[model samples]
Target: MAPQGMTEAALTGFRQQLTGDALTSGDPGYDEARAVHNAMIDRRPAVIAQCETEADVARSIRFGRENDLEIAVRGGGHSVAGMSLSDGGIVVDLRRMHTVIINPESRAARVGGGATMSHLDRATQPYDLATTGGRASTTGVGGFTLGGGSGWLERKFGLACDNLLAVELVTADGSTVHASEDENQELFWALHGGGGNFGVATAITLKLHELPAMSMIMLLFRPDSGPEVLRAYRDFVESAPDEVGGGCIYLTGPPEEFVPEDLVGKLVCAVLITYAGTESEARMVAAPMLELAHAAEMIAELPYAELQCMLDDPAGMRNYWSAEYLDALPDKAVDAFCARSSTMIVPSGTQHVLFPLGGAAADGPAHYPLPWRGSPWVVHPFGTWESPADDERGKKWVRDVRADVQPWSNGAVYLNFIGQEGDERVVAGVGGDNYARLAAVKAQYDPDNVFRLNHNIKPA
Candidate 1:
């Protein structure tokens, strides 16, 4: 049912104002339009406004407000919590507005709000320039950056928000606003790891860096060797240069040629060492891991954009993910991290990942709301399965991983990596002081909390 204030005539008028198109219950593509990345989320928004221009976004917000409809913003439709959709409300779908404009001379890319990582990366790859983006190419650049984006390149270039130069947003009242270092400075600060609480980001400009080459060395071992491999990985990354990045993961080996038939469809400890340099240089840097006994190996130099899509988890899977920032990864923590992998739903897309964080990521701006940036390591249990029957088991395994690492946890987390845990986790993700400051910004821009679907910062 439509909201009390909304009527058929009002919706018809709203559709007429949109340059794109409005999708309602009876619309031909309503079901397809409401489908997000996670198959578990099945929300049915009363209306989905596919915005083509900044003007369309503003008009959608106004229509939602006028009709007292809860507003949900959709970018890449990758919010695991389904924050991009609202039941019987309004969704401002930005997928149609994907337009990436790259300026090679300035080393910058201006991306439309709804653009995915592929859109941004493909545009910049031609110029040999790139920015830190989400690990998945399908992730929305707006949500990823605003939530403190992390990726394979983060150790070298820093988090996505660190590369953010400017943003153009549509506020709750349907007014346009621009944020940058010298303009709307407060709002700009809030955008750094504050999530999408301020407004609907119509567009964002990111600072890019030149990259001539990229290489990776992936090695897989028996799961029993996980502890030793993880311990060695922790020590290796501690001294590795900013250009060196990747993670130690426990996963069901895929049916790739490099993976032995025996290891495929079974748990294996995999270590991937990525370098922003040649294959020879990567081999030299990853020598320690290479010496380990491994069942499979794949070493090659590839384009950064191509590498970004290598680990893309298939869509339409039941997804549940959580993360923890660790102050240290001692041998005991490594043991605990590996031990929990036994509970994981294997032969599936689930990943028990341990990412080393340092280099430029730690050295980025200190005043931003992202308190987890300085943590030396992050343990992410990304759970994805095909069956609803495994939901309880998948969720429990993720929670257990968090519990196992709590002793070394810094209490700060990355919001983009987790689902709706609770309000306290929100405070922990963005610092207590930072949350208070962000609430003030929220009060100014969205006093009514119209954009409350994300990691919400309540208005002051």
Candidate 2:
């Protein structure tokens, strides 16, 4: 099954139309092709094929299946666990397939699976419309949606997967099909939260929302003040309307133009407040954050797209991440955040963020494919490091901190923020009966578990 002896001749007919690069085991570009975002993952994929079109994607899947080669699908290649590449397998590099088509009348955008947050935001901003996306601009739309996307707009609109209208997928058997409410509805449901177990998505059609340009009140304070800030954040998040959502980021202050020179590189808590309202209305809502601590750069009235990139630039950083839903921000949990902030963060945007999961979107039952919804917030530890020697230290810091807050949480992890955890972790992400139901659905669509490469849902 290892494709070691497979020759270039096997894929000759399919190779003619490829405008992108295809490197085999001994090809000069093989190592570089297999190298994903994380340097820690050094997989020697049998073939790394960067595709330029949907046809190219179909071809790659066909070649891999014919040769019994395992498959890894790479969009923006940001998987912390490096699931984007497989050892001695084939990686369908869709990064070159970036395209965006907006239907203003339908309020929808048909996005190439390879597109990033930047692509979606840039396209939708002109129409004063957007949808749920990751905090960073570099994360891929494909992986994010497949894992149940959540963002600042989530509390307003809904989960990224919830807004998904349709998906064009090339399954394990190398057949292309469309997934939507009208057709293949079951498969569509699974892809919303099923990870990559069923197929490789070539394109996604997402529903957009009318959005208002708003304000950003970024507050920073000493680590000692983190507890009070979290409490303030809790009160605001619990009461704020769907028009608002801002996360609490506890981090080591960066030596940036905005941060005070004295506090640069020092441990601090950053409360990033974002709301879809005018300066006056936004300020009234942001009063909670101001009460928590001293304001750093509390500016308002910006373009929606600019405000979308308020967090650090997502590229070039080693992100070892995980997330969980919290029932409430208990005083003890707040203290735990403060304690972790005192020393754990690495310099340059290293932090822990508590993203608000409240809004009209969160007010739902198990109606959609996604599960965990009762929790009002999600706690995430985004561990960043500079050197390989420090990777374990950073991972352990996040792991320990996450464990410390576990008892106070709802025992469910948000799929989008999950990295390289086990099947048990994925099941926990769906919560209670949702996993069993998902398993039954998986049995129907992907019975052989040919798509076991992702946060897998084994067939019942």
Query: For every model shown, what is its TM-score relative to the native structure?
Result: 0.99, 0.93
Query: What is the C-alpha local distance difference test score of candidate 1?
Result: 0.92
Which parts of model 1 have CA positions greater than 4 angstroms off? Answer: 1-5
lDDT score, candidate 2, position 369 = 54
Give per-residue CA lDDT, model 1, range 1-460, as digits (tens). 3444578789888888999999888779989999999999998888999999999999999998888889999999898899999998999999998999998989999999989999998899888888898888899999999999988899999999999999999999999999999999999999999989999999999999998888989999999989988888888999999999999999999999999999999999999898999999999989988998888999999988888899999978999999999998888999999999888998999999999889999999999999999999999999999999999999999999999999999999999998899999999999998888999999999999999998888999
Candidate 2 has its poorest 10 consecutive residues by lDDT at 310-319
Model 2, residue 41: distance off in Å is 1.9
Residues 397-447, candidate 2: write the lDDT tens digits: 888878878887777776667686887788877665677777887786667
Q: Best TM-score goes to which candidate? A: 1
- Model 1 TM-score? 0.99
The alpha-carbon lDDT assigned to residue 184 of candidate 1 equals 97
